[model samples]
Target: MAEVLVLYYSRHGGTRKMARLIARGIESTGAVATLRTVPELVVAGETATPQQADDPFVTLDDLKNCDGLAFGSPVRFGNMAAPLKHFIDSTSKEWLAGTLIGKPALVFTSGSMLHGGQETTLQSMMLPLLHHGMVIVGLPHSEPALHSTQGGGSPYGPSHITSESRRQPDNDEKDLAIAGGKRLAMIAAKLQER
Candidate 1:
């Protein structure tokens, strides 16, 4: 079976929840979704500890082996969190190897407020994937949730608005996430067939 890597960094469980939902969507299409998270970057002189409660830290091998990728992060001032950016910055070897070239990739994010840079964070995550020559997959308007979602759903990718509280994603957000994941898997499968 083809594998889709669902990589993310979650500070307060919002992004993590989105990642699992996306993985479920990926699996619904019969694709294996390998979920991974990056380690937290500790400040100098600070004690380094595992930030992720249980998810394995992502490795270069995950990037090389997966047929597709779904990157998720909590919005940090209109951008992806530091840990995910740090992890991607370390992928020079993979870039040189062209491991991700032509692979289908998508991005997702969660933020504290409705206007809190969710779309920009998604776009920011796509920059690295584009540099690696991967094809970008986005949620299209055809998804009904995109038209009806009052919480979070965008043409760039699925997103969640976690204003004031880290509430569970609303039904519209969930459906859009599932649709994006399924769309990514279907595209990956088609690419593999060619």
Candidate 2:
């Protein structure tokens, strides 16, 4: 089966929830979704073990092998959180090897407020994927939820407005996320056939 890696770094569970919803969308298209999370970055000389949480730590192999990618992160000051960035920065080897070239990829984020830089954060996450030559997948205006969402949905990607709270995403947000995943899967499958 074609496999799409749903990789993320979530704190306070909002982004993690988004990742699951996206994975559901991916699987609805009959593609296998491999969900993985990265460990929190530790300071040098610190002996901290990474937390597994709902998903295990992601390895480079996951990036190299996946047919598609859906990346998620909590927005931090108009950017992805350091943990996810740290992980992406470590993928120079993958970039050099061209392992992710031509794969379809999407990005998602959760922010504490409605104006909390959701679009910018999603764009920031796409940078490394673009460098790796992955095709960035985004929601089009045709997605109905994008027209009426009071919470979060964007042309850039699916998003959630957490208000910095732990509440679950609204229905509109969920629908957009699922749609984005399914779209990514369909595009990936088509590309893989080329």
Candidate 3:
């Protein structure tokens, strides 16, 4: 079956929550949503591996095989979290092979503050996908929440802010993430139809 990969990295679980909501939106459209998480970064000097409490790690092959993608990350100074960027950086082989060419893609991010670079982080996530020739997708103004939301969704993508970390998505933000995923899947299906 064709699948939309909802891939992300979350240290405080905020991004992971967004990923789940997006996955729900993808599956609501009858498209399979494959949720995948990346492992914690291992430093060069670290002898011991960090054990992830939960969340399975993703492989490059997973990204290569997906029909569409919903990439998410926590914002780090107006940029995507390092682990997610590290994964994107490693996709050079796929870029060279044109493995992602024409695949529909979208991005989402969580920030600590209202202006915590969420849009910038989302844009940063888009750069590699653009370089790989994947078609970019984003939330449209047609979504009612986009007009009414006092928090998070943008034409660039969806985002969230939590009171504790300032990066968790509020209810509206979660809805926007799902809407973005649904739109991406619909677009992917349309591309396939064409």
What is candidate 2's lDDT per residue for 1-194, written digit by digit as tens?
67999999998899999999999999999999999998887869988885757998899999988999999999999999999999999999898999999999999999899998999999999998999999999999999999999998899999999863448999999999999999999999999898
Let me know the TM-score candidate 1 reaches against the reference structure: 0.96
Clashing pairs in 1: none
Clashing pairs in 2: 112-163, 112-164
Identify the leading candidate in terms of lDDT.
2
Write candidate 1's Cα lDDT for 14-119 as tens digits. 8988999999999999999999999888888999874536589898999988999999999999999999999999999999999999999989999889998999
Off by over 4 Å in 3: 43-49, 165-168
Please tell me which predicted candidate would have the highest TM-score against the true structure. 1
Better of 2 and 3 by TM-score: 2
Residue 99 lDDT (model 3)? 89
Candidate 2 accuracy as lDDT = 0.93
TM-score of 3: 0.92
